[model samples]
Target: MTELRGEALYWEAFERLKSGKAQIIDTNSPSFKFTKDNVAIEAGKKKGFVKQERYPDLCDSIENTENTRCSAASRDPENSDSIKLITSQKKKANARYSKLKAEHDLCLEKMMNLLRENFELRRELQELKKSSMQ
Candidate 1:
């Protein structure tokens, strides 16, 4: 029996997790955030198996996967504060709306300035034509 190393080891761990063959250790609840140590343990290896310096890709993949899982969990009503999240989202939406409104006003002001310039140019052209006719 040969022991796995590097990418192969992390791949095996992820497979086990996906297949429900292994469970994350040391987590008291489902809401617990996974760490490198958890991945190591899940792979049936020591907590030191996941080294950031040596296995950066594995670590990055684990972090990305965990973030996705956490975000999904956050949307679950039992796992997060729904009212607080809604309030924060609303605040962000209002801030975006205010920014867009300011940009629209600035564009409108520029359009008005251009229209005034066009009017002045037309008035000057009319005066030139009258002088030339005289």
Candidate 2:
């Protein structure tokens, strides 16, 4: 079987996380957690494979899943301090996600502009070559 790479590997790990197929062995509690290192391990990779700079969409999905899990955990009243901590973490995750999303958009725009410029330069070069040949 061919080994998965790039977006495929990332998405596969995410699917495992979302579907509870990834093993939850390391946690002190049995609760399943959504972490980048876990997802990387799930994808048969070393830690830090799910980088925001490399895979923003996958990172965003993982963050959303983690936030949802935290929200559910926050509903438990047994530990008010834990609930407050989870809420705070959720807020921070959201803010970070927003910032990353903005940065990703700006990067995409810059990439598109560069691609257009490259194409135009190539076309101009071809025209000049043809004129010189004629």
Candidate 3:
């Protein structure tokens, strides 16, 4: 699709909205809903939550998709190779998460220790001050 910037984009959107080619969802609208399923899948198909989300626009695009206009992933959403790619990526992601979790837990333990030490030092300082006054 042609990319429109600045006033062109605004005017195009305003015209489309005026002509009823698009829809605007208001807060009190009966169709207004928020769920994890509705979240954008920029993270790819590794997210099962996103797969269950019903997007009318996706179905429309898939049905009307042109080879020239379609993205690489859009070419074949149900391909076996795509599934293999997703599985491989998911495994790598899980490994990275485990590593990060270990590091986070270690850092948290260090923070807790430092806090306890600070409390102990403050208590000792108060006791020393009292002793000096006496």
Candidate 4:
């Protein structure tokens, strides 16, 4: 078959993955993270099988496909630590947001208090002028 390029190649890979024909995997991929596994897997140190297929066929479809639907990414028992890490990251982000929100509320309160004081001072000065005129 003639080689696919650009959009065609992207779709080819996408359709292969979407239809369960092939998949995207980091292992043996050209990306920095997977490049090393090419050797390790070949050396039989890692227990993985290689297949000649389109993109994204390596990991279980559940791990990759669950996000496209309503269900959570189904993880193997060993991947619970990854889920924990994601939860911890969410907590850290929430704490930062709460701190910033509290600081903003305090600043807003101080600004409103200053505006009220300025208005009262102006009113008092106007009354003093009227008394002096009388």
Question: Model-by-model lDDT, in order?
Answer: 0.76, 0.79, 0.49, 0.50
1-134 in candidate 3: lDDT tens per residue?
44334324333433333243433323233232232222222212223332223444433432343232235434665644766877899999999999999999999999999999999999999999999999
TM-score versus the correct structure, for each prediction: 0.47, 0.48, 0.43, 0.45
- Put down candidate 4 lDDT per residue, 12-106, tens digits, no spaces: 44344445444443332222122223322433334333222432333333234435432333435434666687689889999999999999999
Task: Tell me the TM-score of model 2.
Answer: 0.48
- Model 1 C-alpha lDDT per residue in residues 1-134, reported as the tens digit of each score: 34456668777776566455666553544434556777788877788878889678778877887898788877787656755676789999999999999999999999999999999999999999999999
Q: List the residue pairs that clash in candidate 1.
A: none
Return the TM-score for candidate 1, rounded to 2 decimals.
0.47
Q: Superpose all Cα atoms of candidate 3 onto the true structure and report the RMSD in Å to 1 decimal.
A: 13.3
Sort all candidates by lDDT, best to worst: 2, 1, 4, 3
Q: Candidate 2: list runs displaced more than 4 Å.
A: 1-4, 23-32, 77-134
TM-score of 3: 0.43
Candidate 1 vs candidate 2: the TM-score winner is 2
The residue pairs that clash in candidate 2, if any, are none
Which should have the higher TM-score, number 3 or number 4? 4
Point to the candidate with the largest TM-score. Answer: 2
Clashes of each: 0, 0, 0, 5
